[model samples]
Target: MSIMLKEMKAGDQGRVQGFAAGGQAYRRKLLAMGLTPGVEFLVVRVAPMGDPVEVRVRGTSVSLRKDEAATLNVERMP
Candidate 1:
């Protein structure tokens, strides 16, 4: 099943399916933040209120806001 990036739990791994955000700038920012398609990512943590989630990708830990993370579509890894 596909899910929003923010909904993923810690230790979950997935491949980026696509981004739902509009405009090139938002897409670019997401890409720079390591949300590119085909890349695998692991959810590291979710803040207490769940507004921001941390993910490990490209050997780095990146934090994403709930709204921004929602734009990313991902499928769970087998």
Candidate 2:
């Protein structure tokens, strides 16, 4: 099953499943940031206010806002 990125906790692992809402430019930007489907990532951290959450992907870390991440679908991994 797929879950929203905003629902994931730190140390969680998952694969990019798909996006929920985004225009062409937004989609392209996320793709450019390496958030394409099938890519695997690990939740690294969540800010105190929970606005931006960090994930480790492609050997680097990327931080995304909760609203943006809420549009993301991720299949959790064991």
The TM-score leader among the candidates is 2
Flag clash pairs in model 1: none
lDDT for each residue of candidate 1 in 1-78, tens digit (9 for 90 to 100)? 778887778888999998875635467888988779889988899998887899899999989888778788899897
**Per-residue error (Å), model 1, residue 32:** 1.3
Question: TM-score for model 2?
Answer: 0.90
| Alpha-carbon shift of residue 69 in model 2 (angstroms) | 0.5
- Ten-residue segment with the worst summed lDDT in candidate 2? 21-30
Runs of candidate 1 with Cα error greater than 4 angstroms are 21-25
TM-score of each: 0.87, 0.90
Candidate 2 — which residues are off by over 4 angstroms? Answer: 22-25
Q: What is the lDDT of candidate 2?
A: 0.88
Please, what are the lDDT tens digits per residue for candidate 2 over residues 30-76?
A: 78899999999999998888879999999989999877787788999
